[model samples]
Target: MSRVSILALALGLAASSLALTASAATPSANTPSAAITAAIADVNRPQADRDRDGDRKPAEMLAFAGVKPGDKVVDFMPGAGYFTRLFAKAVGPKGRVYTLLPGELATRSQKAVDGQKALAQDKAYGNIVPLVQPVNAPVFPEKVDVVWTSQNYHDLHDAFLGPADVAAVNKAIFDALKPGGVYIVLDHAGDKGSGLRDTETLHRIDPETVKKEVEAAGFVLDGEDDALRNSADNHSLKVFDPSLRGHTDQFVFKFRKPK
Candidate 1:
């Protein structure tokens, strides 16, 4: 063959090899990593929890948050230990998961405390540590990779929880995470411009408000996933309005502490 013909043949072979390698590394159709999928499929997960998988979308959320095996995680105010269980599994044997409950609630709500304690004691959830702390402090035993809270950020302003200092809470969360760690907040969305007005009543907050306050803590707005979003929500009714209880307009925001 001529020199030019030989070079063309070599380049084509190299390109073909690279394509095969790339395809091998990529998961198909958004499936999570094998470790994550294994955690989600663990037979030990509570049957009730498994039933809710359709709506909670645990695998999608974990995948988006970049939760990997052996990454320390904190489930902030993990009521009833729903996500807490999943975190424990995702972190696996080498890692740990902490369930931090608002101190007041831990002391006052026996049921909530009991549920978390039970999970912590379960052999299958050996990686979990249950803690009680004031709403104002996002205390953790050590800096962790991810701090996750679902459907509860707005409660910081509730008369029952705070009028808690949300800014201080955000700062505490920032301090508790290692550099480049993730903070995942999932909550119901209020009407545009609603601000904190509807937090206590409607149990929702404007997504913009949440973004601005969290950004002020010096963390970067990494990305947002709208997998849980529901445009059908009118945003006027309370989250428990019954009409829209199970399906509310929600947002999943992922923020990163700069490395």
Candidate 2:
């Protein structure tokens, strides 16, 4: 063959090899990595009802937060370390999970103190770190990939935090997230126009109010998941009341810091 003909033949062979390699590199859904399977299994472990039951957030919510095996995560007011333990395992050893304890209440509340002690003793949670801060202060070391708060937003309006303090807390959350980082909030839903009244009596807040306050802190409303929706909830019962404890109408919202 002529020199040009030989060169053309070599190029054709290289292209075919490249195509074959690319096809082989694609990952399949069922192809479980040993590390990921182990992490998921740990998350599925059976535990006491108090620690495990309340931690049963919808799987979709975890996906929406973009939680991976090695991303830094912060669980705000991780009262009892329920979600904190899950996050610690989900992130694996390569990732870190910071359980932000409400500083003002941590030392004063017996429950918070006991929870912290228990979490510290768990060998499976070596990746977890406890951060103590005032209810309105965000004392995380730096911005993280995800900041998760569950059923605690209404407490922001409680006498302890109040409106002004809550706004500061919101701003702190915004600052604690990296650009494009996610803030996942799950809270009980109050009456549509009840404003902040439900916060005091029912320990709930209107969804609209949550959206407005979070948006005011410079986060964009990314999306919401209805996985926890319950049409049977009348939105008038207190979240801690026996009637609503496990069945409150809850809203799940995802907000993102702008890149």
Candidate 3:
């Protein structure tokens, strides 16, 4: 090859390599999923909220849930607006995040209603809509793309739910989602054979039980993510136990409404 042509080709290859390196180092504006990027860049997020990211794996969990911009999501029992704020931002301006305050929880503690109401009025979470309803007769204004419940599924059996017909709650959720919608459940894991034995005391439920109950609602188990799992947890201690408070082993399950 001519010397000029050879040099030109070498320069072209070097430029291509640099471009590729730059692309890899700095993801394009379109590269990181909107949901993932928003969760990371949410400056209004409190320091205490950021502090829990290590253990809660909010980014990983949202990615697993397949959350995206312009999606309508329901943050089931959005206690203290933790994931509520993230979901609100994840869905962006065109989308909406409904933070549910079940009557069972609200009637028991006015704090639940007050907290969610405060979030609804926050200009930072402009896309959040507070949904207040009785646990047994829960409903949504419109079908949603995703219904997410984090660290609170076992509460279905809590006395506060009072003869809680978990089936009804599940059915209400099933009815409120689009045919192909997603349901993401993240909760502390109980021992393999524990069943509901420890839910009230230890605040943990067997992953198998959760799957079975959710599947019975006519939803299919789409996938499971162990990003928050910790094999070190023995499943005996309460999730609130001082030793395992933030390190409890948890399971993340994704269920899909049949299309």
Native-to-model Cα distance after best TM-score fit, residue 164 in candidate 3, in Å: 1.6
Candidate order by decreasing TM-score: 1, 3, 2
Put down candidate 3 lDDT per residue, 1-259, tens digits, no spaces: 9999999999999999999998789853224475677776799998899998888877777778888889999998898888888888888899999998788778778888899999999998899999889887787899899999988899898775674788988988999999999999999999998899988999999999999999999999998887788999999888888989989998999999999
Q: Best by lDDT, which number?
A: 1
Q: Give Cα distance to truth, residue 4, candidate 1, Å.
A: 11
Q: List the residue pairs that clash in candidate 2.
A: 103-133
lDDT of each: 0.88, 0.78, 0.87
Task: Report how far residue 232 has shifted in candidate 1, in Å.
Answer: 1.1
Best model number under TM-score: 1
**TM-score for candidate 3:** 0.87
Q: Please identify which of the two predictions, 2 or 3, would achieve the higher lDDT against the true structure.
A: 3
Better of 1 and 3 by TM-score: 1
Candidate 2 stretches with Cα past 4 Å from truth are 1-40, 43-46, 49-55, 160-164
Winner of 1 and 3 under lDDT: 1
